[model samples]
Target: MSPVKPTLKTIAEISGLAVPTVSRALNDAPDIGARTKILVRKIADELGYVPNRAGVRLRTGRTNVISLVLSTEHDMMNHTARLISAIAGEMQGTSFHMNITPYFPSDDPMKPIRYIVETRSADAVIMNQILPEDPRVAYLRERNFPFVTHGRTRWADSHPYFDFDNTAFGRIGVEKLVMRGRRNIVMISPPRNQNYAQNMIDGGTGAARAAGCSMRVMQGTTSDNRNEDIQLGVARHLAEFPETDGIVCSATAVAMAAVATLESLQHRLGEDVDVIAKEAVPFLTLFRPQMLTVHEDVARAGQFLAQAAIQAVRHPEKPPLQGLDVPTG
Candidate 1:
């Protein structure tokens, strides 16, 4: 015979609590005392009790799901994986679960958001790759949807977000190069349409001007381009502007490509051309001990985004939570 499946009634019987009390405790009801909740949850865990999502949604009008809409163009080797892991870990054992919605760069960014909203598939959404005036942000705000962004837009003050201070990162990267007596610099930035790209460009440009150095933002290619494409672009740019001695890269992959291009051209790293790059993980230094790096703490960003998204769903009336992480060293 098959083993018995655990249910709320089963947990109530095992814990010696009424069915309604057990349900309330499991749901983390405000009225339920802490000790009782702990006890009920412990027994439920031991019994392998899983809530019926259909029944719960039917009763509470909440799907208890959070959708994470990610772009396929992100750095798959480390950044994307770490972010997904962190968000999943944050949602574990909570009343809500996470669903990943992958979209291509060529597709409309609004497609997934519309599907989730129209189908009532999730109670909240978490997304990245924000623009200065993101249409998705505007749409969600107009519909009063609960969402949190990994990057911020112009209307960040009116919504929830957890963004790394790319502006500061850009400035710091340039300053580090300038301190080392490297004058002419080039930044391998992201797409011009991205809000963070502009922020970084502005900061880097301002810093270079203040220091009496020349800085240029590379054209025709972005950090999100393929490794070979980035390598070619870097090679071509270096060929045209051989005076570029200090390089700033927006992502790890971009840095790797730039370094490779420099190596191919027999340029000595740290001595001939130094590179400063942003990374979510600590492996960039391991890859090239001579290269300079700044950590973005993408895992921490993921945790913050998860919590902010849930908060927006549960307490829409409260002030939105906003977090900005500046670069350290």
Candidate 2:
């Protein structure tokens, strides 16, 4: 038969101590002696004792849960999975738990934010797909909500965030392609509405101008629904711009399409046509070593977001405001 789960009473009985003393020892109350605390902890570890979160929540009035809000579109690109894994890794060994909630980006992205707040679903939140003037930031700040973002928003500067330096990614992407001795280059970028999209466009074009290389950008698909569209889009662009011999991709979906189109056009990667991309997940490099990629360290972004949310909740007055630029490999 399976053994019964151990509790404070079980520890007290085994240690020959009072129930209250055992409880104090487990909680590391200042009044308890260090020797007693160590003894209690050793027994608890051996017994595999698990704390009752319901009791803890009632005593502290804190859920000890962090909610991550992300877009469904990113799930296809493997970003959501990487971020969640990193956040969970950061939260390991802590009393806190991480929860992921996916939603579609809308004109009013604040709808999901309001839902989580109203339901008291989490103690803190982490959100992404930031806009220039994000209403979610304004609403969260107005309510004094404890939150962090994966990217920056112009509505506020106080909240913590971790973001990839897309401008630099764009600039460096062009540099990498240009180094391959290609003068006519084309970039497949995100929709113009996103702030990162424009940052990338400006960076790529500016760098190309300085290098005396010609560049053009084509708006690419962002959602999984249009997977084939990206491949066809690249094929069309290549057909139209026959002189194009280098490419930069902002999304993995587009990069995959670009590779297939290049093969169809009888162009060799890293030889006839050079390709580079900013990748959220690192597995792309493992599969296609010839296709050079710069990783954004989505896992580290998750770890930072997790820590930022907790700090924002516990120390609102002196919260840590962190802005991270993902390093290229």
Candidate 3:
């Protein structure tokens, strides 16, 4: 059998020091001598010893964990994976660990948030798919829990968050289509219930109006729709709006669906129709030259979310850190 891994106790024995002394030295406690600490750290490194997370948690009254609550709907896209990678990367040097918890968006979103707070499962939380009047925001605020959101909420203006400028995305999407000489433009948007969806619509339609171009929003199709449903919706929209020269999508997945549907209808993209979308995945550009994409920096947003969570925990009374990043095609 493989031998057990080295621990603080093993270091204590090998170094001929008390377990408490070894612990303090490894932690670099001020009470320990600097020379002793240097010796212990070297030995610990040589032995490949690492601190026990449970022990550290018990000692510090902190779980040192960051909880990321996501909706099953949102997890369907590639952006979720990118965001998780970014958040984990940001926390790599810190004591905090990232834990993702997925739940059905149809269920009351507050259930999972409440569970985390009640169990103290994590030191801080990060979440996305924000609502206009978000209950999660209210609950976190009431508990004074440290949290960062990926999108804004209308419930409060003073919460730490990192959001893509959906309004700008809308405007850019419309402008791009106009520049391509496409007069009839339609946007495949997320559910109107989401605050960012409305923002995206306002930006796109507002810009279209200013440019004197014909623009319309096709309802009932959302970013969170099932793949088949998205395809069906796109097919139906195309059939109804046979004059649609351009399409704008809220997400990469939606753009993919639109492309597939257009291909099935024997519509050559970039000629018969032009498609533009906001995507977090890089591969979309590699395969889809026919589609123009606005890439959202989900990785940077993840870093900001982690940083905000840390700051919220360490300095709750400080002003909230709010940020927005523009997208690029």
Query: Each candidate: what lDDT?
Result: 0.91, 0.79, 0.86
- For model 2, residues 169-188, the per-residue Cα lDDT tens digits are 88899988888798999888
lDDT of 1 at 309: 88
Winning candidate number (TM-score)? 1
In candidate 2, stretches whose alpha carbon ends up further than 4 angstroms from where it belongs are: 1-5, 8-51, 75-77, 105-108, 220-225, 280-282, 326-329
- lDDT of residue 63 for candidate 3: 78
Question: Which parts of model 1 are misplaced by more than 4 Å?
Answer: none
Q: Per-residue lDDT for 220-305 in model 3, tens only? A: 77877887898998888888889999999988888888889999999999999999998887766676777888889999999999
lDDT of 1: 0.91
- Residue 312 error, candidate 2, Å: 1.1
Lowest lDDT block of 10, candidate 3: 23-32
Compute each candidate's TM-score over C-alphas. 0.96, 0.84, 0.87
Best model number under lDDT: 1
